[model samples]
Target: MALLYNHLRDARIEWNRHQPQGGETEDEAEARAAAYNEKRRLKTVQSSRKSNKLNMRKKVAQKMVKLCFAKKDEEGVAAWTWFLKLLTELGNAGMSSEESEVGDMPTNSGALASVVVFAIRRCPWRLAMVNKYMEQIDEAALVVLTSGHSKHARVRTEQESEKFPPSGLPRAMYNPAWLTVQKTFLPDIEEILNFSEGSFTMMEVEVVIPGVN
Candidate 1:
């Protein structure tokens, strides 16, 4: 919502700035734009409210709901609301290690991975979600933060070769795995990791370890 409102406000200011100060019918054009904006804004809110109801429903496999846009309407507002709503739910749910998410899959940069861990390895990732991980997680009481949000998240290994350009993505997993995505309120986020320009790769995450050290 904040993102959406900011964009709308910016667009309006730019529109007004272009008007002829004393030109004939200047006020009328401004009024028309304002009215049109209001209607669209209202619609955007309505869509968000509808999605909120859907978000509250608890489903293991169906965590996030995807929103669509009309051909001519701006999509930022709807996207903003959808993300904010996801964040609200995410903060409350303890993150799981067996899940993960990747943004715009076949895309580059600006991609984000939200790692939810109950324990911060003062060391490196153990390469697997162990039973020990589960135990620590339950006692750890975790919270996730992201520029974007989602429901189910998973862990993945990306081991890439230097010759290939992607050095972190694993060439292959010995164990049969359901590659997962580390989700955030918005998969679209700041370049938290310079992992890869496109394709998949391993990204680092900082977790607050559980218990009094």
Candidate 2:
């Protein structure tokens, strides 16, 4: 994950002032051309690295959920705790408190929602011990967190196409596992479900209309 951040931040340091200018000597123009090409190359690299970072987050979330399914309780808690720490560091480094008001970067709300969903479903008892830190989540993130509990709950992915497909999503309602999870978590799945009256209209659009992003 740190490696992914390193690749994302690489763009910030490699910026060079190399735009073509009028009345330049042949040698200077050649140097500028090379630098400009390097700039384009760096842009492509940064784009690929950004995709890698988002993909890594999905994989990490999936792995943590998988560990919970395997009933590796202790390992699940440890992995979840570590992942939360990583996200905190990433958010702070990318958008510090003082600068976030002026920044355009998206919040980690979706990622937090997905991670919390799996934690509530797979390891509520274990989560209770470590989730005190969740109180620090900002109001914007909290909104998205509760949004998933709504009936119109939509599963949004960071990538339209991923190399690794998701598996073992949380159980649907009325299933034994679903009931168990609902019983353990607060707010009653029933009350949360009552909050939303509409269904997710975009759920099947990906398959119905490919390349629509």
lDDT of 2 by residue, 126-196 (tens): 12222222222221132323332222222222222211112222122113443456557744655443322
lDDT of 1 by residue, 1-213 (tens): 999999999998877754655564877667766777787876565445335423432221122112122222234334333334333332222122121224333214766554442221211222343223333332322231122334332233343211111123232211113222322432532233222343322222222231322
Clash counts for all predictions: 24, 0
Judge candidate 1 at residue 120 and give its lDDT.
Answer: 18
What C-alpha lDDT, on a 0 to 100 scale, does residue 47 get in candidate 2? 53
* Model 2 residue 114 CA deviation in Å: 40
- Model 2 vs. true fold: TM: 0.28
Q: After aligning candidate 2 to the native by TM-score, how far in Å is the CA of 66 from where it should be?
A: 1.3
Ten-residue stretch with the least lDDT total in model 2: 201-210
| Candidate 2 RMSD to the real structure | 20.3
